[model samples]
Target: MKNNLTKMMALDIYVSNLEEEKYSEITTELQPSSKKSVNLISWGIQDLFFEKELFNDLDTIKTFSKNFNWKDNVSTVIKENYYESLVLTDAEKKIIWVSNGFTKMTGYEKEFALNKTPRFLQGKETKETTKKRIQKKLQLGKPFKDVIINYRKDQSTYKCELHIIPLHNSSNSKITHFLALEKEAV
Candidate 1:
């Protein structure tokens, strides 16, 4: 279902972040109403939400096209592959969902993570300016990605290649979800 929507939205990278307020701001600014039809925004948000969730589970992400209810909406040629990473969200953001990959990277299982903020991953080394930029963009409901430092359970720091995207219901053009992606480097 989500894969179909991604093709429709032509999304290169799909992500949801824990920081809903910040991601919301970016969406409103970058995706202008004059540029995109309401229908397009609705479809994109719905599809991206499903895709991010499916991507979290190894099985779901692998069998997405086959198991999803929206088989009719997706293309047959789409590929299924999961990227191992950590997914984090704020207590407020958990109402939406989190991905399985999140546990793999952060060593924190979903059961222990739900209702917690991903800011736990941020430490003294995390860049303040980059953090502010991400927060500001998400506050506006926009998509964002950048490299910044984040802490892990071991208190070890690594570069986080982060991606955050906003999901809108579009009935009122409201951003209901913020998707986040975090991969380690450096």
Candidate 2:
């Protein structure tokens, strides 16, 4: 029927917009008929999407841990927190890898953040004292947690909590990288 065809078309459009991350445009353009279908699709798809993302994150963590010979430590950390984003930086504080969730949270794609320092996320509103504290913690070479204001690519500010752990090379027992489990403060 024409009604069925229209609903299917609307669902397709809605899905396309979701894939494009056009969240702001989705609500304004929604129709009553399409809304119901979208709701149903969202319920079904959201779980699968979450599972896939979780698996991907786990795999990334596994790979990094294996490379760094810190599987046991990383596994314990993973069990303790559900992170929204993961960032890996060299000992020098240059970003090396970021999870897809990092882009979702910060609006900065991995490519844009690669080879840059996490300091790029800081802005005028970010506290200098917080920066100093983070520096001190990093120098201590210990795992620590802190919250700070971070700016998105669009320049919007958000409270970000970082659980930072130092990655030490097993052979040399020297710090090689820092892994940050990041989440947006609710």
Candidate 3:
């Protein structure tokens, strides 16, 4: 048991270092060649393995929220609804992060969803009125809950319940990001 624990600790440290390196690479501007190298490293097998293992862990999620300087309310919402698939977006509505459950629920990989708007999940069957309502709510910078038909990567439709919260920068009280806790509506 002690040996196993030691191995686990070592693996955790290695993964942590890799995550820091990836974050550094992402934040730093790089030449095209360096960017390609970073992409290769970012999408390597170990990244996939560790991200899958770590993302579902509640403690890891809490640490992630804190590390990214998310507001208390944002962290609370995330902690309370951790079981639900989470989609976090920049103020512009571009996806910045997603829980592993999001991929499981939508059949879309994290890489595919990153930097894209949640509208990618909508299809012809999605109501225009509902979309407009969601946009308006977002514009108002308020938390709201709504249900809409959303398509998966395979184009299958599902009724998705979205609890959307606009996060603010605690220092400035300005909108920083949006968090959506989502689940399939039965």
| Leading candidate by TM-score | 2
| Higher-TM-score candidate of 1 and 2 | 2
User: Model 3: per-residue lDDT, tens digit, 26-62?
Assistant: 5444223434322355557745654454446546446
lDDT for model 1 comes to 0.54
Query: TM-score of every model?
Result: 0.53, 0.70, 0.65
Which runs in model 2 stand beyond 4 Å of their true positions?
Answer: 1-51
- TM-score attained by model 1: 0.53
Q: Which residue pairs collide, candidate 3?
A: none
- Which pairs clash in the backbone of model 2? none
Clashes of 2: 0
Model 2 lDDT tens row, 1-120: 567755654564345325345765575665565445332557667667656777887788788878777623775676567678889998999998998999999999899999999999
TM-score for candidate 2: 0.70
Give all candidates' CA lDDT scores.
Answer: 0.54, 0.80, 0.74
Whole-model lDDT, model 3: 0.74
> For candidate 1, lDDT tens digit of each residue in 33-130?
57644445586775675576554453432343243222221122112322345343432566223566666667666676667666767889987997
